[model samples]
Target: MGDTDGAEKLLEEAFYNQPFNKDIVTLVFSFYMDTADYRKLIKVAQRCMAFHLADRLCWHRLGTAHFYIGEYQSAVLAFRRSLEIEHNPKASFGLSQPLLALGLYEEGFNRFEERFVANPSINWIRAEKMHMPKWQGEPLAGKSILIWSEQGLGDSIQFSRLLAVLSAQGALVDLILHPHHSDLEGVLSTVAGINSIILIAGNRFKLQRRYDYHCPMMSLMGILKLTPAIEVANEAYISTPASHKNKWFEYQERPEKKIGIVWSTALSDAFLKEHPMHAAAKVKKSIALRQLEPLFHLSHCCFFPLQIAISEEDRQYLSKYDNICDVSEKLSTFSDTAAMIDEMDLVISIDTSVAHLAGAMGKETINLLGYVSDWRWQQNREDTPWYASMSLYQQTFEGNWEQPVNKLVRLLQ
Candidate 1:
């Protein structure tokens, strides 16, 4: 543990000295997983016997390793063993995911509640009184529901569409959106049955503020059974951005098909660097700029580069694109990106927030995905149920985006 190189040398010598030692192999697996080495963990996990472990820690580790490697069912079995040894709530929590992955919704959700605590962290947040209104699975004739935004901006944006769904079900919805999204308040407030929309700017929340129930915004998607085929939100539902209307008037002659480009994924930098086709994108804003080049050259298309504040080297790369038009001077927030997206005919991007934004805005978006995308995208499909307007162009081989880019070139032709 003191020195990684030294430890690896010692471990290699020790393993060579005792090749048949299962305990040593398990220890190595634990160490690898701890260091985020999924490939090695998979190899070690395949070799280890589940029942031979000293404690449930090995099972938990095995389960976690399986989970990371996309072996969800195996993870569930391992986590269940850990749970059976002792009534561990967190282990139960672990079981819920693999169960949900296998489409055991009701059983998974039931186990999920056992993992819920009034307050899991003592330092981050104080223990609650549990006064947060319980959703009793009652009729929502005139009941008010306060939907709070949790997680990141992209998540909030993706889930915000639920307000309409909840409202349609006869619930008076009060949206507590993040302050950075205050610009979206106007857009969101216009939706039917959304009684009020407020930004979370250090305001005191009263539990008894006439709300019958409260739920996280994302949970509604599951509640509504909005899977890929069932997902059909009104394309006209989103509100148009007011700010870009005046800015776009000057560029009306620009083209009939304008598209913005963003090409980079936010998954760990090391994982991102491993993909050679996206090697040029390590320069941060080079992706947003370089990808816009093709769109810029097309006189029939107006190209808007969305993200800004890039390193100087990336700016130099972007400077070489002769047709580059600067929108770094225009984009301020996701709303600004949404506005630019609204004015565009299509969006071509890597796995990023811009893709999520374009999809939520119901714009025809082409998402350039790496060989392995997140679990939400699952394994197969050209389209995501989460965004009907979005189309996917996925890498056929690991660490390669050339195939997707070539496919995009053919489609664009």
Candidate 2:
């Protein structure tokens, strides 16, 4: 294999010789994109764009590179440029996130429809939704509406706040998410206006019967024409079952404050392989369990792992730490985890379901965010209206958790 430096030199020579060649620019784009070299990508992308101004791919590349570097405004322009060139669902989906991140919710939600067309997991669901009368902005008095979840648990939880709006309007709300979330049915039933909760795989014909309208859970925002002026109805949403209130821990009570820690997300290999960019972004969202060794040394705190389970590597690593406790054996459901989080003095989490769960439950949560995080986290803000009890600790540069970790140490001290 050629050394990276030499390979770069050869690519540069080729680009210099055939500056206008689409193939050469594409190669250059791939080289930088795979390497996560956003700055060089920006330079190469701009060079290509100036020559091939009409190229939608170049504009898309430019937008993604800008997005990676946390330049929301520039990313918006570049994605829009790509869209203006052609009707690219990829570009439209790309445009939506940064638009929302920049706090342009109305425009962002308008373009967000393209996600269902561009993303593999969501695209198929759209066809199923089309069989039902899609909810438009209409009066919901005495009407029954179905809201089906599209994404991960965290996404469902984040958007579930909007259900209260439906509740206020005298609409009967029913939910249909994945079958695996049946454990959380007890939890979802607690939401203000929800009449029933069914797993997508369970009682489908019965659940789908005679609805006035049905909507993708995320589309509720767009349907509501959600904007900054419209305050999101966030009152009395998710809560844990009262039966799970009893705390169970091996160690006896100590003066040390109990902290729940979730450092990473659990994702399927197939999903990661299918969405490489999402996989890369997911990589940025987590802290290596090894990287959290310093926090484990805090004698004043006894840490508990709230993630579904620890990896074998992390499990072995935990053998060396006494303050951090393993209690995953008791956590069999989201409801179980919610009960435990209710007992904690605080919860520290990365961009994972636990973060959303803790935030939704109104627990004191310190959410750790990467430089470029989920659109919901947005950019440059310590507080989110989505969760009143959550405080954000964001990385100053991509993949560097040192500054945020140091700040967290101070906060805990």
Candidate 3:
């Protein structure tokens, strides 16, 4: 903490001494970026651009700051200007995010490939070892294709709709997924065209059969020419086993409106250190247990905690509420969470896997988002095209959940 304070103080003094110096400006901007201080980054970026009007790096910094704040239009313009000065792969990739967020599907989808090309350390790229050619929207009739899961479990669930599409195209679809997601085999087996589901053995994948082509699950969006509506329309695609649903029902007493709530997102230590902006936003997304006091005042509504893990502080805080059922112990896997969500009238959650699960399952999910949410939620939207059954309640101002929570309270009433 002292080192951080000292570094910040030095940067501030440098900026004050050489207000128009590009090097000092760059250093200060980088400091704010590393700290995930977007507001300060914006102010510094604007000041830097005032003097270094022709600097491509300054424009790139400005664009990144705007992107983090959910200002897509400004981000787009800033990125474009940076590119006009010098064609940069990183800047090009940055441009795609805002384009996708604004629903410019074609351009965004086309440019999204830059992510893999620019950042080789991305999880999907690291896991991939296949030397085979990637399928590029070609006719797959009589061709065998492998679709491998990438990113988070929620991403795998959300993109699993493409398996049926691949099957419909007459391609033999073989899926490779994480072993932990084995519970989904029964659910996904029902998709029309899947020939087999293979789980990754430890960190390595061994395939029994060779395929003509392989594609990452998310690549289907661009390769298959999918529209947002088509993506969200597959509401009945994922279903909880009847037995699991029945078990959940028997386990808990029924309420008029059983609202499943997930307060905080799980973040690994390494991930938080690597992505300070995401870490900062995650802290903001974690609404305090006491902040939800207004919802408990409503009649005939019971809140079920769907988080898999909770901090000791949170556990002790939740002990105060009798109406809020602590089901964290019972939620051992995604399947268990799904089964409970299957019985819920409404799911009120932060931007987490639970929101994705409820959305994919076609549950009426009210997803609470931070001021600047994930790109999937898009910008300034109440409803997402990614999930027809999901309604987004975003923070109008940073760190303020009062408005969205009050909206939720009114809805519950």
lDDT of 1 by residue, 1-413 (tens): 46966776676567556656776766686557545566666555554454353356657777776765567888888898887787677777777767755656566656655444422631111213435564535667777887766545566666677677677778888877655556566545544557787665543444436567777665565555554335546354554456444455555566456677775443455755565333423432223434434444555554566654444666677676554555766776555666677667778877676777778777888987655454456555698777878888876665556567667666665
The number of the candidate with the highest TM-score is 3
In model 2, which regions exceed 4 Å deviation?
Answer: 1-14, 120-130, 179-183, 202-208, 227-230, 234-236, 247-254, 269-274
lDDT (Cα) of model 3: 0.80
**How many steric overlaps does candidate 3 have?**
0
In candidate 1, where is summed lDDT lowest over 10 consecutive residues?
Answer: 118-127
Distance from true location, Cα of 221 in model 2, Å:
1.6
Q: TM-scores, in order shown?
A: 0.77, 0.90, 0.91
Candidate 2 C-alpha lDDT tens digits along 1-413: 56877878888889888988778888988877876777898888777757754488988988988888889999999998888889798999899989888888988998888887787666333436446677887899999888877677888887877887887898988887766555667667667677888665643344446788888888888888875335874433688877766646434365689899999878766887776766777689989987776787788998889987578888888778878778877788888898788778999999898898898888899999998877777888998878888999999987899999988888887
Name every residue pair that clashes in candidate 1: none
Per-residue lDDT over 1-413 for candidate 3, one digit per residue giving the tens place of the 0 to 100 score: 69989999999999978987768887898899988787788887777666664478878888888988889999999999999999887888898888988888777877777777767655442434666778898898999998877667677777888788888888999987766556566556545567888876565656787788988888889887777765435565677755566658664567557889988888876889888876787787789877888998775887889997788888888777666778889887677888888878889999887888888788999999999887777878999877889999999998899999999988888
Model 1 spans with C-alpha error above 4 angstroms:
1-7, 10-31, 96-130, 178-192, 202-208, 222-228, 231-236, 243-246, 265-302
Candidate 2 TM-score over all chains jointly: 0.90
Question: What lDDT does candidate 2 reach at residue 372?
Answer: 82
> Cα lDDT of all candidates, in order?
0.62, 0.80, 0.80
